[model samples]
Target: MSGPAVRFDAVGLKLGGVEILRDVNLSVAGGAIHCLIGPNGGGKTSLVRCLLGQMPHTGNIEVDWGENRTIGYVPQFLDFDKALPVTVSDFMAMVCQKRRPAFLGLNKSNRRLSDAALDRVGLNGKRKSKLGSLSGGERQRVLFAQALIPSPALLVLDEPMTSMDEVGAAVFVNIIRELAADGV
Candidate 1:
């Protein structure tokens, strides 16, 4: 599905009595990709949070979705207990499953989707492994895998390549190209 154009009009944000963003404006067309670059402590993440409705900001951030508004996000970081015994498959099941509990195992449809997404990120073989045992790169791949399950109309990624190796980066780039071509 083609995503909607996102428009940010005179957006401004403040937190703790400090201005984090000021009159920022941007527009991204549907089926297109946009990148935000800046140094540390810049307002990029804050702007994204505003767009996701996780933060309150001034001005307007609009996503003109026409009809469908399914959004997928791959965050820059995920924190969890390293000692937890959750397997990668368990993690996927937990996030994507609704009707059935993750511990009860993935239902048939979710199993197929999770498998394909994991394979796309080269994590199919690692599904049975504990999530804590994987390196940072592998964990990032897992996060990417989860974002692909529902085939979102709009995909938001923040520093998705942070810990990825060369091979993993190539895989990610390829998937992104494919998704864009398919009007993601």
Candidate 2:
């Protein structure tokens, strides 16, 4: 909890007879903001995948956590049908609510939490709007909102600034600062 949140020792990855990552070594400290910078096909995403255990690799990857440590991830892409008629509120409810059945709908407390999270990302007014109608930036903000519901100790954001406009990016940076200040 107090030291490195993640440590990668001599990490190497290969796929289809090609080397993706080679001899990678790093340690990410707890409560610190770390960025992986590289060009396209530079193994940044692959490194993250390895850390998340989404891909197989060689070497030791260690995670240190306190009791009740939780992780929240916002992926680079969201794969959903563009024609789906799900509303933002409904989508949020599906992701944020754990105790309630989807058919049962969001409870009062869950609704409040979802609303607050949306408000943080300037998406409160669009809560009732259809998800398919949102712009790419708006959709990305909604993803950020979803990640804040449970407030994980470790938050992994992959290329979160990709589709964000100026205002959206500013809001994201501010929220990230606030989260870091709170030792998230």
Candidate 3:
């Protein structure tokens, strides 16, 4: 994908009078994998939020890209109603089906992409399973699957292994290697 380099300059964040981050600067080189490790409340996620433009912060975040600027994100967790009847395929369609309404089901191209993604994450067999019924690790795999549909140039994974089992972790490693090899 030949992803762009990301830079964070003098980033700072405060919420409810509590200083979450202050004067943080970072750089992620193109096609490089970077990890931000810290304690639970040390603002790692907050920093990510700032980078994703989901949080109000004082900083200059830049992505140096020539043309392709697609980004895929896999959050640490997703919270939804367990009673919702959303199946794994349904969720994938909702997220990956860009041209058509998700309620109408996945279009052919999106369906192929979703199937390949789920297969990469070792969740192909669970396509029809209810999202709420899957284990946490399975659900995490689903999240990872969704992010791979359009083949993003920049892939952001926050605590991607939080709930993954050993097998799932292995799959993740393989996928990461593949993505890196593809210049993503």
- The number of the candidate with the highest lDDT is 1
- Model 3 ranges with Cα > 4 A deviation: none
What root-mean-square deviation over C-alphas does model 3 reach?
1.1
Error of 1 at 33 (Å): 1.5
- Native-vs-model 3 lDDT? 0.89
lDDT by residue (tens digit), candidate 3, 68-133: 778889999989998899999999989986678777888888889999999989999999999999
Q: Sort by lDDT, best first: what order?
A: 1, 3, 2
Better lDDT candidate (1, 2): 1
- In model 1, the clashing pairs are none
**Which scores greater on TM-score, model 1 or model 2?**
1
Candidate 2 or 3, higher lDDT?
3
Each prediction's TM-score versus the true structure = 0.96, 0.92, 0.96
Cα deviation in Å at residue 169, candidate 1? 0.5
lDDT of 2 by residue, 1-184 (tens): 3323889999999999899999999988887788999999999989989988999999989988876467777788678998988889989989977777655667888889889999999999998898989988889999999988887788889998878899999999999888887766
Q: List RMSD in Å for every model shown.
A: 1.1, 1.8, 1.1
CA RMSD (A), model 2: 1.8
Compose the digit string of candidate 1's lDDT tens values, residues 1-184.
6788999999999999999999999998999878999998998889888988989999999998867688888888779998999999999999899878899989888999999999999989998999999988889899999999988888898888988999889999999999998888
Deviation from native of the Cα of residue 90 in model 1, angstroms? 1.0
